[model samples]
Target: MKQTMTNLKQLIRAGRGIVPAHTVIVNGNLVNVMTSEIYKADVAIYEDTIVAVGEVKDYIGEDTKVIDADNKYLVPGLIDGHIHSECSKLSITSFAKAVVPCGTTSMISDLDEYISVSGLEGLNEIFEEVKASPLKVFWGAPYKTPYTFPQSTVSYNFTKEVHENVQKWPECFGVWETVREAVTEEDENTLGAIVEASKNRLPVFGCAPMARGKELNGYLCSGVRLDHESYDHEEVVEKMRKGMHMLIRESSVTHFLKENIRAVTEVNPYLARRVSFCTDDVTATDVLEKGHLDNLVRLAIKEGVEPMTAIQMATINSAEAYRIDHLVGSISPGRIADILFVDDINTFNVEKVITNGKLVAENGRLSYELRAPKRSSVLTSQLKCKKTTKEDFEYKVDIKDGKAKVLSMNVKGPFVRKRRDVVLDVKDGIVQPDINKDVLMVSVLERFGRNGNKSLAFCSGWKLKKGAMASSAAPDDNNIIVMGADAEDMSIAVNHLIENGGGQVVVADGKVMEFLPLPVGGIASDLEPAEIARLENIINKAANELGCELPEPLMYMFFLPITAIPDYAITDVGPVDCIALDTFDPILELMEN
Candidate 1:
């Protein structure tokens, strides 16, 4: 509150000419996101707030540091409306170092990945780490925990006590996206939690992908004000028409901006105010190679979006969606001096970045040091699962006669979310995976030392003919998920992950091939971005060598256990029908042929 009063005084004093500004940018073309206009101006900064704009030569004091813009385009520092810091495979501090240089000054992060591992303790740890960073980080409480029946391995029951505790944190912006299946099912516990979060007037984030007509309306009626999963322009337009803020996302796993940005550029440009850009899930490799939110803005401009409009979507639109525009989203007075200098407006090549009145990045390199988060014993000891054997992953089918119908997760691609049922031949009175037909055994084992639960099922489209892949980074649960043609190789991979405290592992012919250990909560690693990227590349190369046909083999394997997506997902309990929010029998009775 004292900081608020101090800012108000600075704004009033600067406007009255009673005090000179601390620093000034002379002769610059400012991209005003609020007005969607570009005009030549001089910006004056008093401390961390932009105190004046438009010809402020008199406000410059002798003690102030002046930066000559030389008519370069000044844009508000980019903000990622939604992201998961853990997806970068780096700690929050390391993730900041990687993105700040790319001109991402602020981000709203969903720490569900960490929360799913350590509950509220994990969330608090992440919040403190982010608070110490140079970037502006906003928190979104994990909305869906224990997302499936029989409970996830690291499930935190979203009880009233936990919800109240989450609300007490000032950094928490809102409850993150709720699973569509829970909302559609009208789960009283989920609905009550939303009400509890809304008591503070925070916006609820939604996750209703492919929800149309009444289903979409039902989700919105539950107080969800924003969605980041809309994949097409039609979905974007429909959501915007219904008063939902659409966050067009371009992540490593999915690319929706090239097609969805057209919703504003061609269909209804005026509705662009209701849309924003987000990187829901991206890795360090993508950020270092392709850029961060700046990549989204450049792509939008190249796809025929007006320069100012694209900037607005990346800046003020995102801020307004989260009700934070008054703080850090524009080049206006009383806002934080989070500004960027772009050499080319059309290409969005950011030359320099400033956050909180300090020069954080210059020439695409971080000019400051980023400290890693202090590790806790609990965080470092995430793998507590007992040793596993081939029997744990075996699927014993009781066949009295011949063939039996089976249910399989038919993955067409990394992004497709439908399951298919197929009939397969049973051999030796037991159901066996037909690797010759591209059918491989998939399993999810409880890894958080809870109940020792495990489930088995068959999957297609993995295209692995010789080896098995396993990772402890499965979404929402952080369970050990592995798919393999040979049960021995699968056991070797899962046991390696268990012995290494949790990580991604690939095994072929009962031999360890490639491994990347993530000792931090079994989800994130303390490794630097370059090292993590190197390990990830090695894993991908091994997967390709093993004949894995998925576009993003690691990501595909990780997301297989996320029950929030449509159709079917495997959990520790069994195969879940996501739309119905219920578990179905893995074995199907064979009909007489």
Candidate 2:
């Protein structure tokens, strides 16, 4: 409180011309996001707040630091409206180190992936660690966990206890993407949580892909203010027309920003203010190779949006969507001194980054030190489960006949939203998968030390000629999900993950080929960003050799169990028809022939 009062007094004195400014940035073409104008101006800062803009010669003093922008573009530091830091496969400190130099000064992250394995205690630890970083990190409370009962091992139902706890946290900006089940089913617990967040004046982020007309209206009427899951230009324009903020997303798994930005340039350019850019999930390799939010801004410009408008989408527009424009999103009086120096507006190449009136990164290098926080013992021990055997992955047929019908998971592309029915020969009371027809066995085992529940089903589209792959980073639940043509290799892959605590593993011919261990909460690693990228590359290469066909094989494989997306997904309970929000039996009874 004392420090806040002192800062306020300092700002007042600097603004009233009674005191000299602590720093002054002179002779830069300021990209004013509020007015969508670019003009030569001088920005003066006192402590951590921008005290003045335009003419600030009177505020300069003997001790004030002056930085000549040299006729370059001075834009507000970029903000990622929605991201999952855990997806980077690095700790919060390392993740900050990787993106700060790319001009990303602030982010609103979802802890749902980490919370799925470690629970609320892990979430609090991550929140505190991010708070101590030089970059600004905001929180979005996880709304969907253990998505369905008996299917997911860890149950976080947004009860009264969870609601009260999240509301009291100062870092929480809103509730993260609410699932369709809660809205359609009108679950009292989830709806009550949404009401509580709304009463506290926090926005609710939602996920509704391919929803149109009445379905979209029902979702919007349920109090969801923002969406990042629109798949096409039509969906983007329609959602924006109905007053929903759309976050155009481009990430390792999917790329929709180019297509969605067309909605602004072709259909409704006036609605650009309601559109923003976000990398919902990115890997360390991608950040190092392609860049962070800077990549999104550059792509938007290349796609024909004006550079200034694209910058606004990445900065002020996102801030307004989250109701944080008053605190950030522009270079105005009383806002934090988060600024970026760009060589050219067309290229969006960030040369330097300043946050909170301090130089944090220059010339693609960080100026400050980043320290990884010590994790708790319980959170570190995330892969607590028994070893598996080939017998555990076997599926016994319930039919006494020669052949049985089964529902097989089909994957035409990276996204697993479609399934088909197949008939398999039943031999000796057991149904075996037919790899010749691209049908492979998939399983999810409980690893949270709860009841050792396991579910099995058949899937296509992996295109794996031979071998198996297993990962504990399954979306939403973080369970050990493994797929293989041979049951023995599947057992080897699952056991490898169990021994390594948690990670991605590839096995062929019952031998462990490659593995990347993620010890932090079973999803994140404490390793350096470069090393993580290197290890991931090796894992992907090994997976390619084993016949996996997807571009980012692990990323697509991890989301196969995400029941929130659409159509179908597999979980510990059974195969879920996501559109209907109910579980279905994997087996099908064949007609008498």
lDDT of 2 by residue, 1-593 (tens): 12578767877999976899989999899999999999999999888788899999999999999999998899999999988778777788888888989999999877777788877777788878876776787778866566553246762334645876777677788888776567777876668768888788888888888878998888888899998888899999898889999999998778888899999899978999888888988999999888899999999999999998999999999999988887789999878899999999899999989888878898877887778888887568847788999887878865544777888878755554687888887776667778778788899887887788888888887777788899988777888899888889999999988887899998998799999998987888878788999999999888888787777777777777878766778887777787777778877874332
Runs with alpha carbons beyond 4 Å of true place in candidate 1 = 1-20, 149-151, 400-402, 590-593
10 residues in a row with least lDDT, candidate 2? 149-158
- TM-score of each candidate structure, all chains considered together: 0.95, 0.95
Task: List model 1 lDDT by residue over 1-593, tens digit each.
Answer: 12778767767897655788878898789998877788999888887788888989788777878999878899998999998778667778778888898899999876777877887777778777876777888777766576664345674556555777776677778887776777777766677669888787877888778878998888778888898987689988998899988899999978899889888888988998888999988887888888999999988988888888888899999999988888888999888899999987888899989888778899888887777777887577757678888887777766544676788887865556676666777665656677677778899888877788888888888789887999888877778899988888999999998888888989998899999888888888877777888888899889988998666687888788877776778888887777676777867776432
Where does candidate 1 clash, by residue pair? none
Error of 2 at 36 (Å): 1.0
- Candidate 1 local lDDT, residue 28: 88
Candidate topping lDDT: 2
RMSD of 1: 2.2
Candidate 2 residue pairs in clash (backbone atoms < 3 Å)? none
Which parts of model 2 are misplaced by more than 4 Å? 1-3, 148-151, 155-157, 399-401, 590-593
Displacement of residue 10 (Cα, Å) in model 2 is 2.4
